[model samples]
Target: MSHVTDVPAASPEIARDHFLRRLSVETDCSDVAASLRGGEPDFVLLHVVGSPQAYERRHVPGARHLPHRDISAERMGEWPAGTLFVVYCAGPHCNGADRAAFKLAGLGLPVKIMIGGITGWQDEDLPFASGKEPGVLRP
Candidate 1:
């Protein structure tokens, strides 16, 4: 076996730990869909942007809108303590979800990023809602 000095491979246990930790901070489209179906109260889903146009076009059903630039610890403090927030944005190419997650986490709120985002949801053929109506999406 040849080993590269610049890129050392992680041991199996280390890799598993890293992946598990990542899973704790990230969720996928299917999981989010299931949560919506079950109406889980442990977490709240949010779309981290203020663009009414984008929102009006399409977004996850039941996701609340919160622009990342406008997020604040004081504002977040109004939420019930220990409430986990699952945030997403346009898609994998967008860093909005990561940015929002970092901001919320810094504010001491539990946060998870919905991997793949709205684009991923659509790609998976998941239902999406448009307009200002929450939880009502066009199939």
Candidate 2:
């Protein structure tokens, strides 16, 4: 058999479960951008990497500057217990998003990773917000 078919695909039930599970914990740049444009999003978007200066240089429109290292129970207390956090880092090569997601999950909070991160966002030719604080894109 060809290398492409060396192994059969998972059963439909298995594939369904896998895709559903991934959707639950992950989102892509396009989906996020669309959400941001659709009015107030239900999730809290966070730029989970870089310093304040780096974040100020460029970041997702509504993303807050919250480094993964700063993620903690006390800091997260500002949000409701059921708040859903969407995190992203430099790109797929960076683990800041994963680190933030892990910390959020450990804190018993809901979280999802924005899969393409900044790189992916740029790949889609989307505009970024620049400023010293969060939600700089807001009117």
What TM-score does candidate 1 reach? 0.86
The estimated TM-scores of all candidates read: 0.86, 0.96
Q: Candidate 1: where is the Cα deviation over 4 Å?
A: 1-9, 136-139
Best by lDDT: 2
Pairs of residues at least 3 apart in sequence or in different chains that clash in candidate 2: none
Best prediction by TM-score: 2
- What is the C-alpha lDDT profile of model 1 across 19-89, one tens digit per residue? 99999999998888877877544688889975978887878998888878878988787689999999999
User: What global local distance difference test value does model 2 have?
Assistant: 0.93
Give the alpha carbon lDDT tens digit for every residue of 91-131 in model 2.
98999999999999999999999999999999999889889
